[model samples]
Target: MRIATIGTGSIVDEFLQAVEQVETAECIAMYSRKLETAKELAEKYKIKSIYTSLDEMYQNPDIECIYIASPNSLHFDHAFQALSSGKHVICEKPFTSTVEEAEKLIALAKEKKLFLFDAISNIHLPNFKLIKENLALLGPIRFVQCNYSQYSRKYNQLLNGETPNVFNPAFSGGALLDINIYNLHFVTRLFGSPDDISYTANKHPNGIDTSGVLVMKYPNFISECVGSKDTQGMNFVLIQGENGYLHVKDGANGCRSVFIHTNDQEVNLNAQTSMNRLFYELAEFEGIVQREDYSSCYKLLEHTLEVVRETVKARTDAKIVFAADKR
Candidate 1:
């Protein structure tokens, strides 16, 4: 798959590393608002073309796929343009600012017969897959707790009366959308949508959540997802079941060391060998596009939609609003 990447953020560096490991995908072009930024990444990745304008990049028929790692506020517009221009899109997660934006993009992707992927890392990780395979061994799941907390460098800036995109409501930036979305995907992909969802947040002065706890109520189990940009801690996920429990030590974004423990024994499962967490998802995207597997794509899309719905509800109920929510 020939690809064009948007944005030259730190994530793009990790993405470029992942692309190097995938035999089926190569980034042919890069786009950035600044020509120097695009040139910098292109030189590092050996990409041939760099464009300052998205329209110029979209017009290139050689670019079969568009990888968007733009800001959270821009995901919908960037993805919509890619889908409309007949290019497959791998959008960075927090797929869009709102459920409505996500639905529209999914609809356009279906109409255009293009592959649309939310670039979530954990779902494609081998350890995460192993968790699903051994879930039955844990008997019936009773509770799940996921905590992904990192003290952002931008947090101090916010404290100093400055707003960074990650904590800024104007850019659809918040802890839930930024970090907790991974936990949402991790839990919802394994257990499906919850019966009820609610959020309690420590809001910034501008009405964005700096830290929050998302509580999801299932028929039999209660799941709590704690994400914070204001604080830091040891991030992990614990799934409790009737017979045993599974623990992930490296948080939801990268399921690095996973252990399953029961009364009988404890086993360590770390199946993912790649240091670059983005590689698994990029490889999966390549296979899906190669096989034209729209069914499987849509199945994942449905899961993403469910996540968007629940997260939107949580944000709304908690009175944490983004500029996109008004739209």
Candidate 2:
């Protein structure tokens, strides 16, 4: 997959690095509002093309896919344009600001027969798959607690009255979408959508969540997902069951390590090959796109849609509205 990227953020840098590890994937072009910003990243990665206009980048026949790492609000616009331009898209997570936008993008992808992926890295990790495979050992899950909290360097900027894209409601930036979404994906991907959902958050003056706890109730289990950008803590996931439990180190984002405790014995496991969590996801995208596997692509799309639905519902329940919601 010859990928072009449409952002100059740190995530874009990570995505480019991950592309290097995937043999089938290469980032050939980059688009940013400013050429200078994109130039730094392009030079670092040895990318030959950089464009300040989306039209120019999208017209390049050499660009087979567009990796979007824009702000949450722009995800829909960027992905929609890429898909309309006949390019496959890998949009960064918190896929879009609203369920309607996600649906529209999915519909367009299907209609155009193009691959559309939400750039969710965790669920595609080898260790994450290993955790899923061993979930049966836990025996009848009862409860799940996932916490992913890292004090954002941008949070200080927000505190100083600078609205960083992440802490700004207009940009669809908040703890839920920005930091804690990994927990949502980890629990939902393993157990499916919850029976009920509710969210409570520590809100800033601009009505964005600085930190929040989302509670999801299932038929037999209850899961609490805590995501915070205003604070830091030990990030981990604990899945308790009738017979035993599984402890996931480094929260849902990395799936760095797993420890299983059973009646007979206890075991620790880590199956990830690359330290860059984004590597696994980009590699998977490369294979799927190479094989033109729409069935597999849409399966992941369905999962992403369900997560977006839950996210929208959670936001509605908490009355945390974004600019996209108004639109």
Candidate 3:
């Protein structure tokens, strides 16, 4: 699939670097608000086309898909533009800044019969899929606790009066949207959307959450999510059941290995770090486009939108509003 990337950010750089490994996908075009930025990305990545305006890329007949790695507040706009242009979209996580925006994108994609995917790449990993298939081994699952915290360098900048994009409310920057979204994904992927959810966050003076603990309640068990941007925390996910426990020591976005500990035995998948499973997500997008399977992509996007929908609801119910929020 020939994809046009819509942001010239760090995530965009990483994606472009990784696309070299996924032979089925190519970065054919790039678009940004600045012509120099777009041209730099095009020249650096050896892409054929670059557009300073979003309208130009949307009008480009050669671009079939758009990958949006822009800030949270812009995700909906970019995805909507691509879908309106008769193109599929793969958007970065926290699907949109709000559930209503997510719903609008979902409805529009359906009306246009296009694919809309969220780039929560780890959900499609082989190890995660395998764990799902063998969930019975955990007996009756009781509790799940996940922690995904990384001290952002940008957070430090915000502390010293420099407004980095990560800490700026206008960019939809906050601990919850940054990393807690992954924790929500882990919970929702295993147990579906929660019966109820709440977030207790450490708020910054600028009205954005710096660090937080999110709670997703199930009828039978409790799932806890810890997400932060102020300070580093031990990143791990644990699933405890009647038998024993399952520990995933790695972070949420890239879980390389997992350990299963029962009363009598211990097992490890021995998943090496070398294999860049992110390639699988890109390949799946290409596969869907080649097969013209918007329905399949829609199913995934529905799950994605559900998670973000709950997150937005949780934030709203908590009365936590970012300055960037639209009334």
Candidate 4:
């Protein structure tokens, strides 16, 4: 698939690198609010077209799809524009600021007969697939704990009365949307939606959640997802069960190493070899688009919508309100 990219952030760099690994996908055009930013990335990736205008990019007949890595606030607009212009979209995580936005985008994609994907890396990773396949080995699950906490460089700025987009409510940026969303996708993709969800958050003066703990209650077990930008911790995912337990050493974002432990046996299952986690999702998107597999794409879109619903509930319950929430 011939693709265009919407942002020039660090994540876009990672996506560009992953594109190199996916033989079926190539980024041909880049868009940025600033021409210099677009040119810099275009030059690095050897992309021929640099678009400073979204309208211009949409007008380009050569661009078949768009990979949106824009800020949280812009996802809906960017994805909508791409889809409305008859282009498939591979959107970054936290698909939209609200479930309504996600639903509209999904509907538009269907209306246009185009592919819409939530670019969640873990769901497509080999190790993640292994975890799902081996879940039976763990027997009946009792509890799940996922911790993905890192001290954000911008967190210090927030302390000194500076608001980065990552910590700003108006931009729909916070711990739950930024870091914890990964944990949500990982769990929901594997086990489906939870029976009940609740969130308690540590908020900045700006009313944004700097850190939070989300609890998802299932019929069988309770899952705790802890995500923090205000503090740091050892990042990992632990699943305890009746027979054995499964552990992911790295975190929900990247399943670097997976280990299964039972009473009598211990095994290390590391199926992911690629350094770039984004490669898997991009490759999967390429396959879906190439084969016109809308059935599979919509199934994943349904999963994304479920995640968005729970996310809205979590944020609302915690009184973490984004500007989009009012809309």
What C-alpha lDDT, on a 0 to 100 scale, does residue 7 get in candidate 2?
91
For model 3, what is the C-alpha lDDT against the true structure?
A: 0.82
Scored by lDDT, model 1 comes in at 0.93
Model 3 off-target regions past 4 Å?
38-40, 270-277, 323-327
Candidate 2: deviation at residue 76, Å?
A: 0.5
The runs of at least 3 residues in candidate 1 whose Cα sits more than 4 Å from the true structure, single-residue gaps closed, are none
Compared to the true structure, candidate 1 yields what TM-score? 0.98
| Residue-level lDDT tens digits of model 3 in 37-154 | 7776678889988788788889988888899998887888889889999998999887888777888899998898888889987787766775666567889988999999898988
Residue ranges of candidate 2 with Cα displaced over 4 Å: none
lDDT of each model, Cα atoms only? 0.93, 0.93, 0.82, 0.93
Consecutive 10-residue window with the lowest summed lDDT within model 3: 269-278
> What is the clash count of model 1?
0
Q: Between the candidate structures 1 and 3, which one is better when assessed by lDDT? A: 1
Candidate 2 matches the true fold with a TM-score of 0.99
Q: Which residue pairs collide in model 1, if any? A: none
Expressed as tens digits, the lDDT of each residue in 151-234 for candidate 4 is 999999999999999999999999999999999999999899999999999999899999999999999899999999999899
